[model samples]
Target: MTGKLYGVSVGPGDPELITLKGLKAIQSADVVAFPAGKNGKPGMAESIAQTYLQPHQEKLPLELPYVQDPDALTTAWAVATDQLYEHLSRDRRVVFISEGDVSFYSTFTYLMLTLRARDTAIEIQTIPGVCSPLAAAAELGLPLTIWAEKLAVLPLLHNLAELETALDWAETVVLMKVNRYYPQVWQILRSRQLLQNSSVVVRATSNQQKIYADLTNLADLSLSYFSVLIVRRSQQWFNSS
Candidate 1:
């Protein structure tokens, strides 16, 4: 009698943004689960969902070491799955929380894969939440993609060549983690004449939201890793020749 597992997305940072359905799922679960960062600190997802967690409910946290290396991530995921395996085998329901839509660049994906590989008997369900990127665009009142135009959502550390290619072919480009290579991204956008048409959103959907249309301050500004830069209808390719 294996238990059911839920991977719920809590939306971005604002607690009010959590969908009613996700909240109901978490509330009804027997145990709540979340992944902490490399330092073993509590996770943001758990913090956001804390208000809704019952006083008697159990919170299961999986410590995941933050590293880009895939091998290291795999190790952490396997270890974390162990923490939930036993309870799940007993038919105890478990809910794993993640920020934004669980499917989009969330750490929960790794654990989902691990459980599947280990043949965990628990049934898994994922509930969608508004992605920060989408909410960011909404804040700016800018359309991410219009009729028949493709959009690319890319993270920093993506190769410059691939970045350029996406910028070239796509009608709109959403660059996440732009803070990692702010200067480089700025230079690329400026050279391609797309800088003026883009908007940089920091702390999207939160009270401290910042939107910048000017690239003049972009080079000096320090953006959060959660930030996103949206380029819409940017057909300007200076050297399209």
Candidate 2:
């Protein structure tokens, strides 16, 4: 008989941010799984969940690469799918975690799709956790979206093209995955005179959390892919608060 597959979200780096429901899922799961880079030995996601994990059980690590190679991703997913499928056959409940909410641009989404196609009866459950966008709002003490202003969460897909488009109308724009393309994001915001008004947060809600409004010197900095940019139109608004 196939067992349950729980998708848990260990919010940011703060263990306390993990939901009580998520803890229960982890505690009862028979096998805990998380993705890693091809060379990442100990899964970063699993390591983050270690604080809430029981002492005796070791985490099951799945290695998936970040680069864009269709064949490689397919192969890696297949191998991982097989490993997870085997656990289900043994009736071992599995909880796979992502850094933030499991569904939001998480690797768990990829695995979920692959697993679903193969087994129609496998039960899948997801629990939401805190994300960096909200965390950035708290860290910088900024109102993300007030008076029912439109808010857009756009990934730094390729360049600042989408960001430029969003700035034209969005009252609050959260640009996620801004690490590799920091300079690109900064240039567009500065050109629009939105630099000082925005707040850049890396690793929000974690011990490594770094917040800065000084975008002038951010051209050379390297940030995690988990970084986020909270952009508001008015500079005086954040200043007054």
Tens digits of lDDT, candidate 2, 118-221:
98888899999887787788878777887768888886557567887888878888888777777778888879887777778888887888888667666677
Tell me the TM-score of each prediction against the true structure: 0.90, 0.91
- What clash pairs does model 1 have? none
> Whole-model lDDT, candidate 2?
0.80
Minimum summed lDDT over a 10-residue window in model 2 is located at 36-45
Mark the regions of model 1 whose C-alpha exceeds 4 Å error after superposition. 37-42, 234-241
After TM-score superposition, the amount by which residue 1's alpha carbon in candidate 1 deviates from its true location, in angstroms, is 2.4
Runs with alpha carbons beyond 4 Å of true place in candidate 2 = 37-41, 235-241
lDDT of each: 0.81, 0.80
